[model samples]
Target: MTTRPPGAAAPATAPPTSGQTPEQAALRPGLKNRHLSMIAIGGVIGAGLFVGSASGIAAAGPGILLSYALVGALVVFVMRMLGEMAAANPSSGSFSAYADRALGRWAGFSIGWLYWFFWVVVLAVEATAGAKILEGWIPAVPQWGWALIVMLVLTITNLASVGSFGEFEFWFAGIKVVAITGFIVLGGLAIFGVLPGSDHAATGFDNLTSHGGFLPNGPGAILTGILLVVFSFMGSEIVTLAAGESPNARQAVAKATRSVIWRVGVFYVGSILVVVSLLPWNDPSIAKKGSYVAALDSIGIPHAGQIMNFIVLTAVLSCLNSGLYTASRMAFSLGQRGDAPRSLVRTNSRGVPQPAILASVAFGFIAVGFNYLWPDTVFQFLLNSSGAVALFVWLVICFSQLRMRGIILRENPEKLVVRMWLFPYLTWATIGMISFVLLYMLTDDSKGGGRVQVLLSVLVAALVVAISLVRERIRRNATQDALASR
Candidate 1:
């Protein structure tokens, strides 16, 4: 563990490069404080919150608030643990790097690749989603053409420099934040019978009970709703990864960790509260128009669908942009640690990992091709195969933090800027909750294909772990042979 004196002045632009490997030193700290701030704020608001929450609302009724809260709490804990490690030692690899030192080489190798796989797959998903919206707006261009354009534009944004990625994300996330905040405010007004020209019949807290009543589908649906909504929280950890490129990495990480609770509460749970309050959970429009759009349309907002389409498009682009940046950085980190090809560590004069960026996007473009070529079979398999990765990632973070806490405390107590509350007990509880979620996923075949997703994800994770073990053994044998020669 590397430790700076308690009161030493922190670097203004990048993490200390002292004793850094060539690959680690190559990354530039071009992300400003404002960029990191918005990334942290925007990281909590994924497109899933806007487009995917309707089914959850339907499944749990108004009690879906509880589902979001439960998952939000889970994310809070995981980020806390991750923040502790990241604050102590900022790394582009983030949790994967912590896993390497705390668990073993295999732990880091498996999870890093798994996380990289998750994001590149996300690139295809977001690109296709954006393409659908673009095709709707401009009928002349084909969906595939829109996808190609979106990918190329963002790829260029990332390739230009890390600062450009941050600037793009800052505005993309800013638009989403403003849009959702506006929805919540307008919806809240209509619910209170204060908004003029509002004639929607279903409004107020009574909607929670007037219909089938909260939790009308029964208490089990809350768990079912968890399956629907958990993945929406996937990008919340992107801030920790982005922190590595910030000058004030440790302080930025600590602040982001502290703010996650409210961010999740206000953006996710708060927005859904307005949605359910503005209309009954079971309203036909809720399912047809989506939660946000339905709430806006209920209040007599014009062109609700198109308004949401624009917001969703912005979110998809933000996600695609962050997805490419994240996947490439993780690959660059993997290369630094010898878990990937040495070529991945190669950077251009601007300190951009061109090879890593190209490698990630190459896979993304291929995934987009699969989506078009085999929408039903191959693409569906790809989606399900990566579905449970978020849970897998949080689970690994819980385990890694359990070991990393002790390691940090022993090696350098001063570096513990962000501490996980209640130590081992809360960590253990988080582990239990995550494990239960995974186990529960195996039993349900709800809207998200929980059972199939979990089973396929497990199969894919096992394959990666197997590869990691084989690589470790081969490397171990090589080291032993060198010792014998010596």
Candidate 2:
């Protein structure tokens, strides 16, 4: 594979020639630098961070900050490896394409389909979450109606053009960033006894140690906290896929990789710190009202719950918008490489992958139907089946980077604009850490059926891998037969 320098224009594909089909047309570089920047920033902030941190804080107490840090570090390392490869060769496939070249066709096919499955499930999950909020606000519409409306709006945005998706995500992510930043600032002032009308007794750093110390449930709780908060970091890798469409794919990817550390530290660890420091970790309100909302209420903020709901709603929409885009792009990439139906590679006059987007949203709509029709049995199974896919994707990146490093260096060392820290050693360490997290998930069942999620996710992954291997064997046999006929 040839490599381009950082900030260089992406490699161009041949324009449609006479009698050539539009299916052979290339994806347009419609995403701007600002779009890419916000995508990278907003990718780290998920709806889970807004709604999910409460359980983690309850489990790990103030030590939940440590849990965030551990997971943050893992993400930073994984992003670095991904950045190194993506910078060298920008593709919408992102890590999946790298896995194909570095690992094997089977590895890429398995992980690509698994990742796609994960995001389409996420589409249903986010649509439902957003619909609930909308329903509460306007009791006129049923929850399923709201779900259909939310999915339809974003699906239209994605179908319009990549730029439209970026525009929507830009504002959705912007709201989340501003809300989190404001929360941190106000919570910090209250913790220091500076915010007026704040409850001095409740808003102080003493909350961290006053009640059972930081690790209230012993050190073991930190691992449990890891299980709770780890998935909140899932969206951080979306930027790499988005970067592939930017004008300067290499620079866009490298910049996002470099800044991931601070993004995690400030948005995740820093915000959680403000939460734990503002109120006692064991405070029932924290668990009941969520970490951020409870923190705002302690500082005498009026309508704290409503305010947080709005922010969480924005986060949900952002995740939904990006989920559709990411899933479709992965499918598009897979199609380009012959893993998926060639129909998915066909782009419209505006350069949008129409078929791919429709295909992804079609399944998303089905999942939404299952969510309403069988919330307990069918939807629960779908959720569990895709639960551990985030870790699986990260593990694949680590392994792909291990082999891709040599390929990049041998071909063009200068293309290594974003290098992984410590090379093979750090890469291997990341692999071990992710594997450990997956294994740890097996023994823990107290939090949201951890073991069952892992087991079911493993079952799904094994089935995908089996299909990939079978397909590869058939393709190889066909090639041999064609050669024999020649």
Candidate 3:
């Protein structure tokens, strides 16, 4: 840590709303605690966890659970830092605003834009996923039609009001929560051989070690599993970002971060455990079908796969909605801070950022056209470019909190409601650990052109730096010209 001057002004550390103007502050107290709580719950349980755990298990066997645990721990650490920052200065901009204040204009510019990129990419990906599931259910409709319907419907809901979006998400998240709870309940019963038709004798804890032993490929596989499954937790932190728009943003951040572990850890580990236990790693259906629905179907539930596809569809839509909202909000914030074009600062009567909405829609349309054309090239290009941003965002959160913490401790320690454990130590460790993870990913086989993606993301970050520098110079020249005229 760098030393600070004895009398310099430290950044204030009160909760996030401390920085928002009155107008922005009045947007909406519309999202209730229930909505936020469920958002936190549902955010952790994305389509990836339900359908993608098979890939992790295949890569690492039963040791995949350890992979999730490592990532979960890292997320918990990162969220704690984010909570500390959000508690002090919750705003619609969330970490972007924090980055601007604590780091500098360029850090905020780069990280904020990178995050917007991530969400936009996510918006298209979720829309596509939702479309595929809907097309399966209604073959008469083309997949692109399903994507359009999904986007426009959610777009209208979001445009209506914050309350409308929150309410829509509330029910969608409710369905997911109930379904996952039911899954755990049913899987538990089957595990103990209590279910009505639980015929699999290998459902007990013995399965953990029986199949070529627990670490089938050795302890190294657990690390490999982490490489595969860490991305599944990507959407979870979006809750804190979204919560900045809620009433009592600081409290929401604290509460959401406090409970993140249980949501990410239990759901991930619990679900994956039940999965490998229910069926052997080498089972064809695990690869042929998927891990989530297949696990339910194995327990004699009729149409479990279809039911799960529907649930996964809901998950995808929820993500698309949130993705659109997040990207737009970031763009709106950037415009407000002079990092983007001024037009995005406009808001409709409903306080919706209409320009931001249109921008998001424009990107979605591009994704739509790409999907219609050569999806493989476009999707791969988008995925690879945005692949490294999550780490970048996490790194920003860590640095922001590191600087924000001291100012907070000195100025108003009482307001530090949701503090990171071990503070400076854990904060530094998280930064280092994440650095190592990035390095590890560079060498992973599954990365498959990850290097190019990482390289391009770095270039994007550099571009932001260049723009910020140019903007600052222009602003200074204008100021000098005005002074000379006077």
lDDT per residue as tens, model 2, 346-464:
88888899999999999999999999999889999999999999999999999999999999899869888889999899999999999999999999875447898999999999999
lDDT string for model 1 (1-486, tens) is 223467776544334653222224568878899999999999889999999999999889999999999999999999999999988888889989889888899999999999999999899999999999999999899999999999999999999999999999999999999998988888888888888788866456998888888889999999999988999999988988888777788889999999999999999999999998888888999999898888888889999999999999999999999999999999998998899998998878787889999999999999999999998899888899999999999999999999998998997799899999999999999999999999999898754488999999999999999999999999999999999999
Judged by lDDT against the true structure, how good is candidate 1? Answer: 0.90
TM-score of 3: 0.92
Give candidate 1 misplaced runs (Cα > 4 Å).
Answer: 1-23, 200-202, 446-448
RMSD of each: 3.0, 3.6, 4.3
Q: For model 1, give the 10-residue run with minimal summed lDDT.
A: 14-23
Q: TM-score for every candidate vs. truth?
A: 0.95, 0.95, 0.92
**Segments in model 2 whose C-alpha atoms lie over 4 Å from true places:** 1-25, 197-204, 446-448
**CA lDDT, candidate 3, residue 297:** 75
Better of 2 and 3 by TM-score: 2
| Model 2 alpha-carbon miss at residue 171, Å | 0.4
In angstroms, give how far residue 450 of model 1 lies from its true place. 1.2
Q: Provide the clash count, candidate 2.
A: 0
Clashing pairs for predicted structure model 1, backbone only = 13-247
* Reference-based lDDT, each prediction: 0.90, 0.89, 0.79
- Best first by TM-score, ranked: 1, 2, 3
Ranking of models by lDDT? 1, 2, 3
